[model samples]
Target: MPSRLLPPAGPARALAAAQLVNALGDGAFLVTSALYFSRVVGLPPTRIGLGLTLAWAVGALAGVPLGQLADRRGPRTVAVLLAAATGVSVGSFLFVRGFLPFVLAACCYATAQTGLAAARQALLAALVARRDRTHVLAHLQSTLNAGLAVGAAVGGIALHYGTRAAYLAVFAMDAAAFLLCALVLLRLPEVGPTAAPAAPGRGPRFTVLRDRPYALVTLLNTLLLLRMPLISLAIPLWTVTRTDAPGWLVSALLVLNTGAVMLFQVRTAAGVRDLPSAVRTVARGGALMLASCAVFALSAVDAPVWGAVAALLVAGGLQVAGEMMQSSGAWQIGFDLAPADRQGQYQGFFGMGVPLARMLGPLLLTALVVDWGTPGWLLLGALFLGAGLALGPAVRWAERANSALVSVG
Candidate 1:
């Protein structure tokens, strides 16, 4: 019965299906990417990291322009083209023999992926009502995780085989998935640009860069997103090195996170109907994350193995709760605060935070929490609390400014 509670038919379902397929491919690729590059492709570890890092940077830079293009053209059209490009770029990885070719292929894949994401968000905004956007987003997130879980399992087969041919097969599957996703997108109804004509000299180009309140909100949301690395990278390392918990608990923690999102992401989105409610959701999520941080700190204590495992489970649950809440709230804020006409550009700018977090989070968390231990966790908690508290005021400021702009116009 719960499985039957799907997204409504039409564009929403289509988009969700496409995202599920694409994300499944991403999940498979992610599992094998590092190993495939190093072992199969024969690139050095440092080169792989460097290439991926440069790729991400290139992708981040591509977002704004591609999003703007989506606004100028149709989002559906742009999205389809970008998806095709992504598939081609990813498939090209099979031919990469050295650092330069690898980096080049990575940049292409990352750029297309980023651009496709912005286009997809804009397309979603076009298809769904403002009131329903966050709800739809929640469903999409759940579907993505589910697909990723399945894909990761499939990828594990290749990992187990540990053969070049098997890895290539996985890469080919990922490429095909992207092309399939593109076909799915083609089935959706075409939605054109929402922007109205600008007055004599006042164009909309780069306007998101100048919007201070929205910019601040994006910054705060990015800080909140640091939870990603904390769970994925730091927690596992901490569990093995510092805690008394068994190594198997690391897998359990990841499953806990993915399982929570699949089960509760949609449920959590129900309460976030308006800007005020969204803001409250984010604040509450921040508090939950702060508490989770403290709990995670407790896991590092000199406790019995069972006690540490219990602490880890509890902390992981809290972190997932916080993630679902914050994610839903952030989607609402990003969608609601943007000028309706420029959703593509605004969403593109908002998305820049993700790549930035991915770039900086590991170093920051490793230095603060991983290296320093309990004090680092406490400091991270303080950061979360401070950022969460600041969100309410920041959102209010953005709303007022937007209202002022509307009245002036």
Candidate 2:
């Protein structure tokens, strides 16, 4: 850590640190949110889940518009605004006694989160060179997970000892992080949006949807996202309410998942960094996810607790592997392909698929399960596997298109 040898200690570095801090707070807040809604606010699981869906929908709908705004202004300015807005929104939760006000606060927080996310990703791409982009993105994910580990542990402790005060503390920390992030962003050199790159001939922004290869990548992302509901809402509810498992098992399972991330994500992610093959990377990630789902399906057979635990560990490892591939591929395509001017818009539009899936997937799975029993989970697994298989053609198309483009240039 010699001073002269260190990477530039500017806005980019500062913003990355600030993201870690804010993520820590977010992690703590999420850990307590469900319990707070249930015990403090007296909302049932279904209502809580519905609220999450609404928040996600609001965020997803706002993402593209926020990105467009970031293009007009600067990504830094938009990011700062988003951070401050999120801080205020989270702090407002303290006074919200009823469902309506609470939900409103959640919606506001979600909207700000999406805005900040678009700005953050765009900022990263703008700051880095093409060769280093994948490494930087991987580092960001690892840093976030590290922050989450600390936050989650602290949150659990806070809940066990302090209850509602703990959650409030988490929000307060988030607010502070937002303020710090804004300050750090102000110190960094302003990087203009993609509409105004230094290079000649390339336009300010390339329309991502019009590019079939990128569009297919986005579509694959959406399809992959549909698989997340199993872990996010469906499996937890099924395990806690539908099965004989104890409520504490949910926490245990999460621990297993987090542990796998801690142990495996970085090492696994390095192998897949920003190769020219988006489709192949995505396919690999999808295949791992499919395997994880199959393991999850096996858990439905009334195995012993140890057997279930084993399945959980295996599934969790698969999740980490999938995440590594998906994350690497996503940054490679979204950041590398975009010209300097429109990175914000491209990343923003592409990232919306995540929130869209979050909103839609759970509802569909829940309804199907209610109507079809175990068949719903089976169908979900099938969808994941099919999505993985379908990515082969998409990847081939991307490879050929890229080759043709390179040849023409």
Candidate 3:
């Protein structure tokens, strides 16, 4: 089968480098966007939050449909198109300030982001064997985090100059990065459609939801993901209102999280590559997230600057651990479970869940935090803990089902 596509570490590194560049640009934009909205455009946090929600919703809904299209045609072509579109969308923010204009730009960026993600993942699966796919995915994700760390540092410096100037700078960087990604993507080979017919009676894609273990894992991991939006929204607000911690602290938290991912993700994920052990790993990761939430929740109550700083550090570590574990387990399972021809759609479906959570989690959690304070954090902790514990049985079922599939194959 064409000597098993992803040649060796050398080629993989090249692909990964390209991905890192794109991620760096995305990181810069992400850090700056909200600040630009609030400070420069004079928009409220609520409007900024709504814009993010709508953008993520659009991204999630587009995943499977875009995956289907990529499968029918080739992922490379779609990847190039998506990357170019992302550049334009990000660049448009330089000119647009009104809510409608911003929303349109966000929609464009979201759609392109979703398309690129599905295509790149499908590209990797097409190029590599199932066993290697997990490793590659982990490496790719880790590198992306590293790039983000670098990007955010640069973005911070840029923002110090002026918010509008910072947005313009990030826009340029993002556009350039997308262009580079498109160029790299064009060099890759195509992976065609699944072996099963796209026509009906081949069973529906939604049937994948019936895989009880996979579904539970998704749910469990998602609950742990609460830390992301919580930290993203709350910590900054906390710094502003509760503590005298400087803006650099927020940047530090992000750096800590990304740096941990870059350093430990591969080593940490390597041991859990197999299906049997991945479940245990995910469960442990969930525990880490619960711990992180507890730290965050407690820190909310009359914390000193140093204490809050310590909390941020602890929280960042826990977040990286959870992200590493869940990312590894998800990649391994998705690669193993997917049919030879359906990798694109499978990965696309897996990815859709995150954006869906991002869409709903922010407003809900933020509002709760506003109304309840410490009680809100306590409730979030309980929810995450329950989700983590619940994953055990689900993982057990998935492992058994996975074994059955292997036997049949």
Candidate 4:
């Protein structure tokens, strides 16, 4: 059962354990952050949002540079430093009382979090064989979901108590989690960049951006990531305002989504071996997402509450299935397409898609699904379907470009 829950006892296991611990803390922090700032710190909602937005922006900008640093300095070392920084940043939030301090702390946390992600991906790329990367990622994702479920439940207790001490304890726990993650990373073997240094005046300084095919893949991958906001932000709102489902269904939907990821993420990843298979998986995920959207839209019809509840359950299941598939495919493709020597930079570039999606997804979904209603939902579905179909061609183009580069070199 332990082996079933994770990979073998090695660096993979350590990484999985680190991810689980970090995610648990993150889950608790995510649940309590808004309330902590609003109620405990007495900051206004607008200020809180602004601070977080700026923080994410800072983090996004820092990703590529920090990733390149990982290439130069070694991923394991860089990841450890970034993890420590994350802990410090989260801990600093304890002192934030006003806008500027909040922004500063949040930005620090976000930047460290983003940089840590890139470095960790590079570390994984170095530690694991290419063939096993996706499988390992799947296990990590399942572990993360399980940790988040547990963390969220624990956080709910604090939230229920609604005390400043509870909020403070949660923050301290999150900070401690980062520190513990850093300690785990410290024990991993050093995995340096795999590629030789570039020839003088030959390679582009920023190889990832210059790689148009990979860029297009990244953009399309971002489209698929719209599911994050759709599930987290849009779905809850939709359930409350647009559908006949009971309010309690919102919590149930979250549980359903998490449960599905825990159950099937690893299983779904088993088939993704090569570029073609990975691309196919992503395309299929897109179709599933489209189906999910359509089913969710159906819940808006004047149906019985049971029917709406049933539709939501179905839709949630489909959405999580799609999520698992897309994640598997993205990891496979991102790792495969990346130049081994520049894994840090390449994964950093790929990682940018998530923040980009987070920045825009909520507004886009709100405008389309919430404001525009069924028409918007259909439009959104069409957009997903089109992107899914386009991913194959995009991947092919990337492969052709890589081949051309290799031939020229």
TM-score of each: 0.97, 0.83, 0.85, 0.97
| Residue lDDT tens for model 2, 288-363 | 8767766666665677776766665576667657766766776676675554667777777778878888889877
Tell me the lDDT of candidate 3: 0.72
Question: Which residue pairs collide, candidate 1?
Answer: none
Model 3: worst 10 consecutive residues (lDDT sum): 1-10
Q: List, residue by residue over 155-242, the lDDT tens digit for candidate 1.
A: 9999999999989998999999999999999999988877654577786577888999999999998899898888878999888988
What is candidate 4's lDDT per residue for 271-379, written digit by digit as tens?
9999899988988988888898899889999989999999999999988988898899989999998898899888888998877787778889998998888888888
Kindly give the stretch of ten consecutive residues in candidate 2 with the minimal lDDT sum. Answer: 1-10
Q: Measured by TM-score, how close is model 2 to the native structure?
A: 0.83
Q: Please list the residue runs of candidate 3 whose C-alpha ends up more than 4 Å from where it truly belongs after superposition.
A: 1-8, 37-45, 163-166, 195-197, 200-216, 239-248, 300-308, 368-371, 396-409
Which residue pairs come into collision in candidate 4? Answer: 195-341
User: What lDDT does candidate 2 reach at residue 204?
Assistant: 42
CA lDDT of every candidate:
0.90, 0.70, 0.72, 0.90
Q: Which residue pairs collide, candidate 2?
A: 193-341, 194-340, 194-341, 194-342, 195-204, 195-341
